[model samples]
Target: MQLAVNMLLKCSESNLIERIVWLDDQYCYVVNINEASFPYQLTLEEVIESLQNETKVIVEQDPFVISVEDHELTEAELSKREFAWAIIQSIYVIPAIFDSKLRAQLIKEASEDFGVTKKTVRQYLKRYWARGMTKNSLLPDYMNCGKTISQEKSFTKKPGRPTIYDSAIKRAPVTEEWKKIFRGALEKHYFIKSKPSLKYAYQQMLKESFSKKDFQSGVKVLDLDNAIPTFDQFYYWYRKWYKADYVVRKREGQREYLKNYRAIIGSATEDAKSIGVFAIDATIGDIYLVSTLDKNNVVGRPTIYLIVDIFSRAIVGVSVTLMNMSGESVRVALANCFDNKQAFCKRVLNMDIGEGDWPMHYIPHTILADRGSELISDSLTSLTENLNIKLSNIGPYRPELKGICESYFGILQQHLAPFLPGAVQKDFNKRGGKDYRKLAVLNIQQYTQILVRCIIYYNHRYLEGYPLSKAMIEQNVFPTPIEIFKWGLSRGNGRLIQLSSEQIRSNVLPTGDATVTAKGIRFAGLYYSSKQALKENWFSQARIKGSYKIKIQYDPQDVSVIYLRHDRRNYEVCHLVEYQSMYKNVTLEEVRLLQLNRNQQQADFEHVELNYQIQLAQEIEAIVQQAKAEDDSSLPKDIKAIRHNRKMEKELLINSKYEPNNEPPVFHITPIQKNKLSLFQAKQKEALDDDYQT
Candidate 1:
């Protein structure tokens, strides 16, 4: 039967008898053995049988058999041990003895040339190749002292097949038992928190002689402590067991390291500046402010719709109203921005959500936003085409890209929000979450009021980014965008700004002629048109113009065609237009129906225009009827003819005493009457007349 053992050795014929004793497996009784000169492996049974066959006397001497124990392994039967010993001895050799021919240079060359794995080469070196190349640095002659091996209990050579008695599974030599534990038992754990080196704390702990458990636990909490490997023999076990994966070897010079670090940091900083770009987002607004000056108790916060100018960071336009942020604040804010210079917006403006696509009117350049879904709201995309913005998103993890608006809000919160008297706050629990991104709402009024006050400060204050404050003031760098507008205008800016619009000349005020007054002066949508206009049913359409600042008016439909009367262009020329805002539809039947509706509506409104021709015809008919009733004796034919002619001419002209004459008297030519020619001519005429009378 074959058997296996952990180690093996070989010896030659002449030394075999001395190296081998009988059929034992555990220990060979060595008398005088030259292991290198006589290399051989022989089973214990072969030796025993050969000895029996050769000798005259057969003596059975299984001397002093000692029991051995090791990790619960029982000794195999004699037959197996015999062969096992042969196999083990065949592999055994002096631990550090190497073949003379093997050289470190040759090993290195072979290792490189063969392209062998480091592990495999390491195994070869450990097993068969390293002895000749390595230095004997592991202490003294003690390293190879066979006497020392005999002195150690683990290495004691007992009789045939002695059980491995040490119980530590055939113990390592006393010289290396601890090293084995250090290397094997406690290495290679990656700790969660890095251990800090605490030289002073360690010194104190050592002085106090704290137990190992106490030391370990205490060291964990010290902040200044560093993960330091042991420096003394006391730490030898740790050196082998818990050796750090990384060792910090201090470089002799920092110039190269600093230069490389600077280069890396500089490269990263430079690249971060320009790579990802974003587009500006635009939003229109309508707002209402519950009059702040009013003493009445208000139910809700005053609302103001403000159109934000993302580029220069300005409020492009705004309107105050008593309406919700959506229909009122949002629309009004948008209205102010889209209005005619002198009128409120007559056309629809655009807004877009951040999704890359929107309807044609909804298209914008790009939207810069965070992960919030409202930033990509679908309702907001309704007019994306009108605003030229784009959809851009920052990486999911990055915070700096969306920092512009955040930074602005920071400024608002710091300088403005606190001053607001009645900001409302709604906790997240109350949000109900239908709108996933509703920011915690606070009373918007207080903050908005502060916002209005702060905006002037924001605009006019000398900004650090703009250096020359004096130059800015002198150059009017901080003019309100309204004053800065250079579009359509008449003579003076103040006239445009300060003109008292009640009295208009030329029957034409330069206002966009979405409306006209009774005096024939064209105005924007707001004025009271004539009572006569009411007869035409102009009032049937519930149109109302801007109450205050700029000119704007509304129609139930057909919002598209309101034109600028002075320039004679559709309102579309001014800003982006809403398509469905117009009342008109394309079909001819629709048009006819609209006209009929309009006629009926106009006639039904405040007043109506009575046709002059119809009235005149009725008057003439009345006269004819009266004459017939009078038996045709009312007048003669010639007199009636003249009177009828005069009456017809008057009716045709539709003259009234109140109407101004088209022609004015000219003084350029004057021929005096004979009596009034001159004082002398009058006297001569009087004298001649008197002589004639006499």
Candidate 2:
């Protein structure tokens, strides 16, 4: 019944009322060119009833009959000439025709009845006896005749202006001089960023065509006699000769014009099997979301990472985060794609999905992404290599190459984001009515849950105008993306490269290089060491001449621990030390900010030290006066000032006691000579006695 209704709707849409008509109340009359002699009359009520009952309607065959054997022939196997002879011979075989007085009358009647020319009948009768009535004898051989020429061009004149007009026009209207000037103007105007108007190009052509030069004797040389073509004439010639160039120049700024207008000779998605090519990309979501930790704090738009299968158009993985688009987000999204989504839904959202509700949980054979810094980092390359997945980047600014993933972002924004409270309007004018930031109610977790539900719904729901798979097209059915994926899987063509949780955690996480110091392995200004690292004496080992770098994988969301690849198959987990444990739940961004703050504080301390050096004496005097003013022991004394005063007094007293004298005194060498010892010994003994007295 629905099929009939749909057919009726199509017929109405196509304006086929004359061909399809409702007759009486029970039947529908269909008029067809091939069925002119016998029209079709279907019982509409009976068809609908049969459809509702899930039964078939049997169609009967026509009763009219005709055969060539009804008429007797002179020869069973007759060629064109023999058949003509047979028709002529049939007149005599009929007794009534043989009895006719005039045989010409009978032959004429036979020619009319058989729809043949009398001339052809006569020619065939003339050659009948000589050809022995055989079918092969009447066959005409074309060995003597050459190849046939096209009738339309056989008598037509050669393409070019006639000689009569050549002399009259003298030279062509678009001569070599005209072509030179027009080409120069076109190059100056059309093939440039300014993209000047056609009228301006014509003006330029005129300017170049007419030029003047100053002579050395002050006489002017000018070419003002040549007539320039009108703008319309130039436009006509340009349209005829350089239409493609004009189109290219007109659509220069539109990237899609090149993609759509130009011919693409190679297939991008057709060569891949289901789950063969996965395109990953990130976009800022339209709706605003708050931080999960603080409901009142609005984090603005979240970055959404999408991983779409090129073949099935299925969104295999998605990640919604307050973090910017970076390698970390890509890693998390890829891990989600490789891990079982059923388990993920249960663990993350606490919602149990049915078996195979989300069937995508395998690494793609090839991953396609844009040349974004986040997607093209060393970590992603290393991860893809470890997973044995090929990575490719599309040309710059060519989103159409990764169109499957790019289009999904728009689809989600159009259909889902607008319905949310904090949804941002695409047009600035539409946003004037409401404050979208104030409307933000969903946190990152809540938004993620909504995103998951939306992905599931998109997979299951039917999408119109989706390209049908080969099987679906053959079966005359339309299926959703998930259905197409399942169909491909059932045909045993889709590949599922499943990975263990450990494999995913090790290979899909972002990686960085760290060095083992005597204290521990330091990475990102923080030290991390495990019991296993200590047991293996990694720190005590001698460092190489350059950097003793080791490969480590870490989660950006948690800086507490990092995984060190100790051997081919083992990864040891190393935690931050006690002093750095405060960074346990901190993000990588926070850690970097904290390091910047510490460096800033150290700079501030150096600035203070410099100021103190310039006022050293004044600071000492201030400290001494403050200490003397607080003389009462019961009162609270300035301990810091007192310490400064004591340090200053000690330095002054030592300076006075060890003061050096440059002035010369009266000769004291006489006393040394009178002594019983050498002059040097006497002086050393005198200096020792003075030191003991002091």
Best by lDDT: 2
- Per residue, candidate 1 scores C-alpha lDDT tens digits across 176-204 of 54344333322222121233343433344
Off by over 4 Å in 1: 1-294, 302-329, 337-382, 387-400, 417-450, 465-535, 538-694
RMSD of each: 44.2, 27.0
Count clashing residue pairs in model 1. Answer: 72
lDDT of candidates 1 onward, in order: 0.31, 0.62
lDDT by residue for model 2 over 1-694, one digit each (tens)?
A: 3211101111223322212212333554333212221124667676557546645332211111111111111223324535664575566432233233554576677788888887665444333322222222233433225654443233132234444533211223565567677777877876666666778877666655554564665644334454445566578667755757346746364454434553332244534755468889998888877654456767678788999888778899987765688888888788788877987666555567876678777676678887687875555655664444667767677899888799899888888766688998765337456778888998666677788888888888787887676767886655788878766543433434455455666567777898888778899998998998788777777353333788898766557788887532367789998887766654464466557667998998997888888799788999999997877653334465587558666766766666676333233335644563375567767877898999
Top TM-score hit: 2
The regions of model 2 sitting more than 4 angstroms off are: 1-267, 272-275, 287-300, 321-329, 342-355, 371-398, 415-423, 427-446, 464-478, 515-522, 525-529, 534-549, 557-560, 575-587, 590-694
Predicted structure 2: clash tally: 0
